[model samples]
Target: MPIGVVKTERSIVGVACLIHKDWTLRDEKIMVVNLNIGSELLCLVIANGPNENERAEIQDEFYEALQRELDKVKGKFILLGDLNGR
Candidate 1:
């Protein structure tokens, strides 16, 4: 199905997916920027969620989660986030 500006808000907030005319996958930290692009797809995997956490303890869990989400991606994708900056 086609998708739009699907977003989720909470401790971790972001656009779930911006499907101009299609939907494929989405969950928690798994954000599908474009479900399909001719034959490729783009996704932003978030583990720490956001930079507004304010907490100084968030590494192991974040990295672990990030790796897990990345594994779920099928073919093509991209990951965005500040590691040391956080």
Candidate 2:
């Protein structure tokens, strides 16, 4: 399965690309992609199951990173990603 994920609204579900599969896990489940809809900037992230310490460091880090990326875009962006609460 793809480690990182970028969850998007159903409107843009028809278009997407799977890339940097390995890049997913290493980069804290973060994936960057070009969403050429209304906006040309997007990123995909996927969170892993809860690790020790009652939290997943990688997922947490990716969430933080996603925020930074969003700040850079500073426009209408689609936040697409998967979170494993269980």
Candidate 3:
């Protein structure tokens, strides 16, 4: 469940988390990256939530963690990934 961001040569980007542990959970289900594209700062998050078949607690924890991460962002952001929700 590794997550990443790809850019072309002309793109300007900065990664907030250079190490995997700094950006993702133990399960590697979620990842966050703070990027500086030119003068604009963006908080980019990629997540993979547990499926419907997963346990309730797992689902709860995933949503809670996701919310906590989003709450920490101070500026503009884009959340894109498979939430595994209905």
Off by over 4 Å in 2: 1-16, 19-28, 38-59
RMSD of 2: 9.4
The candidate with the higher lDDT, 2 or 3, is 3
TM-score of each: 0.47, 0.42, 0.66
**Which order, best to worst by TM-score?**
3, 1, 2
lDDT of model 3 at residue 12? 27
**Which tens-of-lDDT digit does each residue in 1-86 have in candidate 3?**
12243434222222233543434432355668777779988877877677788899988998998898889888998987778743
Output the TM-score of candidate 3. 0.66
lDDT of 3: 0.66
Steric collisions counted per model:
0, 6, 0
Report the Cα lDDT for residue 84, model 3: 70
Clashing pairs in 1: none
TM-score for predicted model 2 compared with the true structure? 0.42
* Candidate 2, residue 77: lDDT: 50
Of models 1 and 3, which has the larger lDDT? 3
In what order do the candidates fall by lDDT, top score first? 3, 1, 2
